[model samples]
Target: MGKHAKPSGKSAHHAPGSVVRARPLPVRSAVRLRRPIDIWHKPALSAVVALAIPDLTLWALGRLDLILYTSAGAMCALYAHGLPYAARARTLPWVVLGMVASLGIALTAASLITSTALLVVCASLVAAVHKVVCEATRIGPPGNIILTFIAASAFFVPQHAGQVPLHLALALGAGVLAWLVCMAPALIRPQGPERIVVARALEAAAGLLRTEAGTGGGEPAGVPHARHATAAAVNAAWHTLFLVPVHTAAKAAARVGLERLLVRAESALGDAIEASAEDAPRDARFAGAGAEADRLGGWARELRSGRPLPEVALSASQAEELAGVAAEEPGPRRPAPGQPRGVRAVLTRLAPGSPLLPIGARVAAGCALAGWASMAVGVGHPYWAVVTAASIYQANTTLSWQRALQRTLGNLLGLLLYTALLPLMHLGPPAMIALALACQLGAEAGITRNYWLGSVCVTPMALLLTEFGSPVPATTLIADRWIDTVVGAAVGLACCVLVTNRRAADRIEVALGRVAAAEAVACRLLAAGPATGADEARDIGWARERLTGCLVELREAVEVAAGEWWQRALPEERIAHAEQRGHRALAGLVRRLSAPALAA
Candidate 1:
């Protein structure tokens, strides 16, 4: 039996000393408050260019009515943020195609079915499918929720079979435009994305070093956050590097150099974690790590600007240490596998036992309920309520609550902006297009900073979209929005409460066990002494990878479970202990791999 396993006969329902308690709303820390400006510039520019150029052209051609379909396709621009150009090249097209496909299905369903009940069912099914696919693929933010929002709303749009192809063509054209807009930067700076990702990792490493040094070896509260940030940055850097195809010797060499730098960064991270855990004194090694991190960050900046690669420099001891580790010759890089193919595979992966399944079900239920409640209460467009409900379903109930509050607040303020702009919009399509573009820019600009800030623009843009078909009175639109917001937020949060994830704690225990098991396996391998052959070395590498993956999974589980309300008190202390042990085990593995060089 595993060390972390529950004692026999102690029902899973009742872990020893565990008590059910309601987790209070984390009001202060729920939403990130710091607003950064530069990070959003490129995405905002991409969205505006993607949306405006086509819209203005359509208006010029007297095809302003077709802008709705085109804008639906262009909305795909909102995705692919933080992805490397290589990944974005694939991701953007996928998003556009997915949007077009969903639109086609919605249009067909609307044309074929006359009954509202059937339409609702169809929309609910689409939401479920989107939820499953997005979660399975790990598409990150702006996930399937936005895609579902667009499709669900379109389901109610009156359409004919003949109009489907033309509308789809419009969407396809705009999607192509969005793809181009997002990919354009790659033309000027082929390695820019990878550079940024690597740079971020280095910066995060430096941050952790600073925190460790400043705390005088005490485990500060900020240390975990910094560690997690560094881990995420490193993971993203590797993924980005892997996504880029190396077609030339020059590119391959460059990639190898980046990989070497990345390994050093990882080593530095391991050192910091171990030092912090052991409460070691700040030493020359720590200072050297910080300097190396700064150097790597500068290299990233130069790469991003298409400047020449900086010369690598290190002290004699540092060079020997790196050379010792490099002598081991780590395992060959295996191609990262793609997401599982086929609906069956995806569904199986997201089966009832999966953590994401409950969230998907909650989304479907909330969307359906919000739509029905809105219609019951005589709101003209139930889709708004449906979309609102979809948007409120985040990774956890705590986040969902924050989104609900942000969405409501932003929408209310947006309605006021819409009211103020109503007179200007009546001037012409050009004015309306300009206002929409501005709102989109604003949305993209602040979205990363804060959800509410982004929604301030998103709400107005959505309201203005209603004006494209026919003029609805501002008062009526405002009233409906407020009513829908209330209904959807209330319904969505209610679903969150009713559908509690009892397995959350259990999953945390499982993750803890996995981490323990993997750590033990790696530690055992290290204790057996350094790898004597290629196969043994590869085995050690795989073991370390498994351990790292388990640690990542464990951290994610703890974060999600921590945010859940009304659950048994988690064994947080035990989880922390496991993490510390895991880190020490990893550090030991790193030391063993570098032992040959260190000894020399």
Candidate 2:
């Protein structure tokens, strides 16, 4: 064995060749779950605005006869879009479209189907349709199902048969309003604050690099402190990327820049931690850099108060040199640490032949099975289809199954809460509108902290979205929700079991290529000539940063794949070894660039 055993997270355990954790889920310590306030704040603000808008509209229109709840629910969709799931914005329009289609089908079917039992079956079928479309499109969050729930619930609302057209128009009107609200304000470039945050994160990464290079002296206390500061900067950048449209040229460029910074910071941290070698001396150049990091970290905190970033001087040559290092190409490397290969297997099961298929067929099948079953059983509502679709969306199919269970359980309880609240609140338009706003905000606030809590509000919001213009029999509504939830949860889970992916190995290979390319760029910058090559150095730095991001992404993907299926990919140990080796090499590259030759 080599002298270095390889760096491992003290708590992480992995199966051989598998990226998934081989160990059981740990009981985390009572530390508060760390969510960035920045991410939380946007949803909070959006929630408030969403509620406020509907309230105003209801008052202005002077009509409980309107589909204010539809607008309210659609606005809730906007809130979900801002979250950091993969391809978030790309998924929003599909979710909105799903909502529209679900409403259309549910309303059309409701007019023809009279039996309470048949109505429930029809609602479930419609919900299944919504789930299928969303899964096909990789629509936003599982919350996409809520849109279906909203439309179906409206079916049970007691509207005079003749008023159907007016109700449909009102609902469509509300959804259109929501679409405009989402599309319009996104034009405003709130770049100043975001830029400052990104700059701060970059500076912190630079400072950390400098500290680790034998340049600084501080109590070991500073390491943890610096890590904390770096985390804040990273989280802030995540917030910025999550909110804007990534496809736009400017936003895309900024995202690329920010991602590069993130990659650099992650690589630098991994390198610093590894180089310390369990008790290595701190580098001399790191002293000033550590202090600078601390200073930048503090400045970042102040920036939260809307203050501009305080300009601090850097040795222009050193800064330029470091930028160059970041711009270099990625080199050949081994696999990353703690990746899962099982998810890739599960993905393959779904696609069979086409690995890049966007729609998760396995997931859709589960939803369909649940919906079909509920229909056969004559359940009151197809809450089951919604539940089934909502639960199994994790990175791994196994985790998705667990989430589906949790979501179903949570939704079941939430339905009870709605039952109790509906009668007490009296399903009038004003009261319904007020409740919608409150629930939307509450759901948004709780989503980041506790999914269960968010469901509490989400449940009522779903239920009330139906009563926008009419009331439903409370007993039938509540019963159907539970039946649908159970059926959907069961069906969704079953599909996950039946359909799995098989091409995790190929994906991992592709990911490795990206990492190697980025690393090569980084190595080139490290080997560059003097500071006179500043422009070239800057470009190299950006390239290195991009490589780092790609590696992180690949590592995460591999881990997910490994977790879902253990025997499908490269040996878990090999991947981990590769990642550690990569980390060491990258760190070496960073140190070389920061050396006297390059800095001078």
Candidate 3:
């Protein structure tokens, strides 16, 4: 008996909590339409609704007090970015709490210390602390709010201690409005994009597994397209994960379960690869594998359509038989008679490949430049700094530098353009309100594809936001922007140099090694035949978790490897061949483990 199979008399059904319905992708078109309206529409709507109360309050407060509006608007910007909607829902309270505390501390500190340098130092330190806290606690969106509150409050610190309460109240008011804006989406149908993406990733992984097993090394048709699609799907999944907040204990638990499953699957795949690689195949093995691939392709399509899995269940004895085959060491051989072609195909498709976006020194450099520039310039607001910092991000450092340059140029032009328009538009509450919404939408629309386009909207938004309280000369606004931009671009680039990462290949190698080892172990166990005890399921599950983790790590490492200039220079052809072979082995192992015939 294999080490991991259940005993002969035990029930094969998993424990009640073990199963999780991997949700399929939400029904939505992949391609976007009407770029301007599409991009701006949601954020604009959100801004108009969310900003109304706060703007109105500023207006009611005479709109001539620069302190309130600039401070409040800075807070509003803090509330802007996140997991689009899900994080919006989960982040409000945390943001409010963080903001209030920061406002109070800034007010108190300002009262005690009157030096401008001290104020900047304190604010930057607070920014660093907020970032660290968010990372440490996984507090997410609220962390930004805390940082924003500190920056905004720093601008007015060294005020009488008695005024601290008013500053906090104003921040509280703005935060409340921001929360409302973020939450107003209940009025419309909510699409859970993040949830859908996660589900689709599982499906894609399954499809990949099936395809590798079925093809048996014949030139893969549409191989590049399939690989790209899978890569895109994975990217979408990760992005959504970052944005959304799983608020409920149940949801968090589910995430843990899912993470565990992925980990196991990766470990098992590695073991399978080592075992299979030892055995070379005959022509008949290739032909039979091809037939199975076609069947698994059908299953992949079915999964995409949200079809249920197979209804048949193996008895305890059959499961043991199945487990034994999976644990066998891999070498080229024909499948045991009557093994389902579909099952075999599905297993074959599970190979590793390139990542979606490669990360490297260039990205790190750009990020650091952006972060430092915003800090040093002592800008009109820290939000500008953050946006500039974020805008510099790219798949690599060179790209990051390119984007940073683009943003600086764009901001310079946009600021000048806004200056020209300043004389024509009245600096009244009504005009400011309208301009705010317009710039908010404009910024949101351009942000998706082009940083410069987004900067246009952002520039106007920052400038106009500053004008809410006092009438600053358009010339002054323009000058400040240019100075900040230059600082951000220079500092951001330097950061890229300071944080250079050259270990991408090593990470990829580690992932590959892990996968290979797990597969070998799994195959050896499978070769030993069926288990005698139910407790062996623990070993099986543990192996599966390790295998899954390795697969995920490999995928991530591959994604980041190419972003480094060095990874592209390696013997990619050899690596690619190994991946193909390993994928096939893993799929074959899965097919044997799950086959109904093995139950007999």
Candidate 4:
């Protein structure tokens, strides 16, 4: 929505008294293609390359039936791409392990259980794990869907206890290869991920300026979302910076350089917030802020160019603020007292009442229903149905509905593509294998545009991967997957509606209560006096972060709840009051800690 669009609840200029309504289900917006991510090719290229060696070697050896295991591990390369190499190195192995474990469970259950019904139940349970764990780990794109797809497919494959270890070993080998492939760029460009995140911050900041200038003809809506996005990008940059250890003087300097750019991005974001409250009419300050935004955009370009971080001019206060932030990080490896990390964090996520558990339950129910329905309807590939249903469970009912629509449309298109590619499959193994590889690559590349668009490649790719085994008739394959897709989408959407995430709505109350408590702490700290020692300053900064985080969580909780079909009305007045007070206290902390580096 651009210049002419009206302000919605999330818009920066919405009146406080205006009604806040749930977003009616998205249609045109759900399927619309947006701009590509900053380094969209990284995961796409990484996944396809990681898959190629395993696929070709298997094909050459007449063992392409094992692609499921290797593909599971190869897809590991898709994860941790956004994390700094230091973090990526530590995280990728765990991702690989999780993938393999999922496959193992599926295979063992498939081998032992004679009943097809029990097998579907086992597959659904695995899907539930895949959904919860992936979200808990915060692993990025392709996410649990890839894991579930592979494991569900494996559940249908003929397996014995004897074959499990060898298949697992193949997956482990491919996973090791995937790790190396993802990490290889570090030798040449150690800070590439860090730089990419900073560049994104700059671009987001620039968009704010364009809106301020009212030069681009759009609603000036999504301004709030952009502000939050820029903040997230900057936080990611800081996290990446923390991942870089500083044993050498040279490394320390590189980190400081990147930090300076991040500070500028934050400063631009601050200006956008101030600009939002003004009726400046393109006045001098707005003009100058616009210029500053342009400069940030240019520096962002420099960051992505594989060149050195461009020298940025900053005032003494800005430098001090940067130093203050650097001092506050406490290194990336350490977890805070309340924020449980690693396994503890995973358990915390699975804790009863956690929002993620509800979503996981939805996946399990939807997958079971979809798979059982497929068998009832006489479709042969119930696993395909299972995977589709598993993939459709999102954070809430509305989003799941959106994904369902996109998935159904994409699968239909993918079937048409498969028909057209019948001749290519007849070209034999290499051609068939290569075509599937292209689908993998295309899925990664286009999926970011829209899930359905990516599915155009994914659905066909899923079908083609089956061809690696004894060939199935194209007509039978197409018809089965098509039926599965429709059944899965319908069942998944139903589950989403029936399985309301009440916790998300409840979380809004929790967040607000936390905000009220945090605001009181911040207010007391502010009243105590200006931040003096490193300890006091750190406390203030931590308090600010917590308050800001709670506000974001509260806003998000409200949004998710409002979209849910059967949720109760939110306490909008309380939420509004909490955010307003929390923000005021946070501003005080920011001003005390680093007024010049950040803004008022």
Q: Name the candidate that leads on TM-score.
A: 4
TM-score pick, better of 2 and 4? 4
Task: Report residue 47 deviation for candidate 4 (angstroms).
Answer: 1.1
Instruction: Write candidate 3's Cα lDDT for 197-275 as tens digits.
Output: 4445545544544454555554465443344344445444443543433455554444333322222223223322432
Per-prediction TM-score to the true structure, in the order listed? 0.88, 0.68, 0.58, 0.90
lDDT of each: 0.74, 0.52, 0.48, 0.77
What's the count of clashing pairs in each model shown? 1, 77, 64, 5
Task: Measure candidate 1: CA RMSD.
Answer: 5.0
Candidate 4 lDDT at 167 equals 92
Runs in model 2 lying further than 4 Å from the true structure: 1-37, 51-69, 76-189, 192-274, 277-293, 315-359, 528-531, 565-570, 585-600
Writing each residue's lDDT as its tens digit, candidate 2 over 447-497 gives 666566567778777667555555668778777777777777677766655
Return model 2's CA RMSD, one decimal. 8.4
After superposition of all CA atoms, the RMSD between model 3 and the true structure is 14.6
Comparison by TM-score, 1 against 4, better one: 4
Q: What is the lDDT of residue 187 in candidate 4?
A: 93
Runs of candidate 1 with Cα error greater than 4 angstroms are 1-18, 277-293, 313-349, 531-541, 593-600
Ranking by lDDT: 4, 1, 2, 3
TM-score ranking, high to low = 4, 1, 2, 3
lDDT of 4 by residue, 1-600 (tens): 211122344443443323443345667877889877767788888888899999999988988888878888998998888988888999999989988998888888888988877788889989999899888877878789988988999898888999999999999999999999999999999989888887887887787666666534232557656655665665556556656666555766787788777656655655555545445344643667666777878888888889877887654555654566555434452212465656897888688888998999999998999999999999988999899999888877777878999999999998999899899889888997899889988888888888998999998788888877547888899999999999999988898887878787678778888889878989999899876555565566567556656666676676666667555556656776676566557556655654544331
In the range 416-502, model 1's lDDT, one tens digit per residue, is 888888889888888899999999888877777878778888888887777775568888988998899889889878988788877
Local error of candidate 4 at 204, Å?
A: 2.1
